[model samples]
Target: MALFIFRSIPMNTYELDCPAVPFETVGKTVAQVVSRIEQRLRKAELEPEWVVAANWIDDANDSLHGLKADALWPVVVEGESRLCLSVAIGRSEGWLVQIDHVRLHKAGDGGHWSSVALLRIKTLTRTHAWAVAAAMSRLLEID
Candidate 1:
């Protein structure tokens, strides 16, 4: 028999502070964040319970517009995978969602937005979810 080798890798876990993270209802709020999340995942080959939503708001004064901006909206997928989205809502009209940039480092110091393409929701691909998560992490200063 051939020799079989196995190696164990250590994993890093990130936790969220529910009391620290701030969120607000978008639009008329007929549909909650959970509902929107469900819709997004329904098209994927995954179960609803496998997904989790996390929100973040910018605490810095440099936030866009006069209103506080929603910095990061992370959707956990397939257990260890995640799709993080960042959006800013116009005080009067529809929300303007933009992809900031992606970060592969946990330090959250380097990475340029131009390295990643900013695609609209319609043009976004499921294959790019990991990159989106990295971008959101950089935007939120989370790495």
Candidate 2:
């Protein structure tokens, strides 16, 4: 008989084969990219030059209302819903890479992150829920 055990964290984490794909490095590692995302949002800049989680910046107040730790960008490929990427600041210092995939679910009430395939996003900053959506277009077709 085999003893059964369950883990709290989901097991559908995604890992980017950055090396396997041929995108020139921006002179930074994936960790660096994530850090930049965090730093930019923390600043009091008027405009969000870099893309944010669906551009949650409040135009009138100039505030990031829906902005959470894991800023998400969703994408739809061939009618299939896919998360483009998610970025967040690290707790101690860097991004938590172990099991770093966002579990796809339906967006419940209160205007959660919704997708065409009825998926939702839960952005957790303190806990280890940071995730980045996969860019289907970029990953699928590489030069």
Candidate 3:
């Protein structure tokens, strides 16, 4: 008989294949870029609520000034009937904007949510922010 031994090896989550796409800044600073995006959303009559993530900023208000290029900023927009949009500010390599459709499930007394990515648009410049807002508007059919 031969003795068998097995060892558990930890995996590095950061090693995952996450390609970074190029992003061109429309404004001189990150704050300006975010402001423009908010303006676009308002023009479409969509109320945007910026949210804070566990590994991200502590306060939502901090997003405007402390946006890290290597970190992601999540923004939640209100208007769609059943769909929701989330925008991430940056990635390891460049800036990326992703839009997802969220579905809510009711369980007993509590509820859970699931999401499917509707679009993954790499922002090449500041104009891309407006593009993202427009895509969200069209998807939600706000007007």
lDDT agreement with native, every candidate:
0.32, 0.32, 0.41
For candidate 2, write residues 38-138 as lDDT tens digits.
Answer: 44323412112233332233233212333233333223243323333334554545332221222344456433343221111233332333322232223
Sorted on TM-score, best first, the list reads 3, 1, 2
Number of clashes in every candidate structure?
Answer: 1, 6, 1
- The TM-score leader among the candidates is 3
TM-scores of the candidates in the order shown? 0.20, 0.19, 0.35
lDDT of 3 by residue, 20-137 (tens): 4222332334344344444544554333344122223333443232333233332334532243444456554334554444555668888777654333334444444444545444
Q: Please list the Cα RMSD from the true structure of every candidate, rounded to 1 decimal place.
A: 17.1, 19.0, 18.3
Residue pairs with colliding backbones in model 3 are: 24-124
Residue pairs with clashing backbones, model 1:
101-135
lDDT of 1 by residue, 1-143 (tens): 89989898642122122223323322412124334433433443222222222222323442232112232332323433333355444345433333322333333655332122122221133323443333334333334
TM-score of model number 2: 0.19
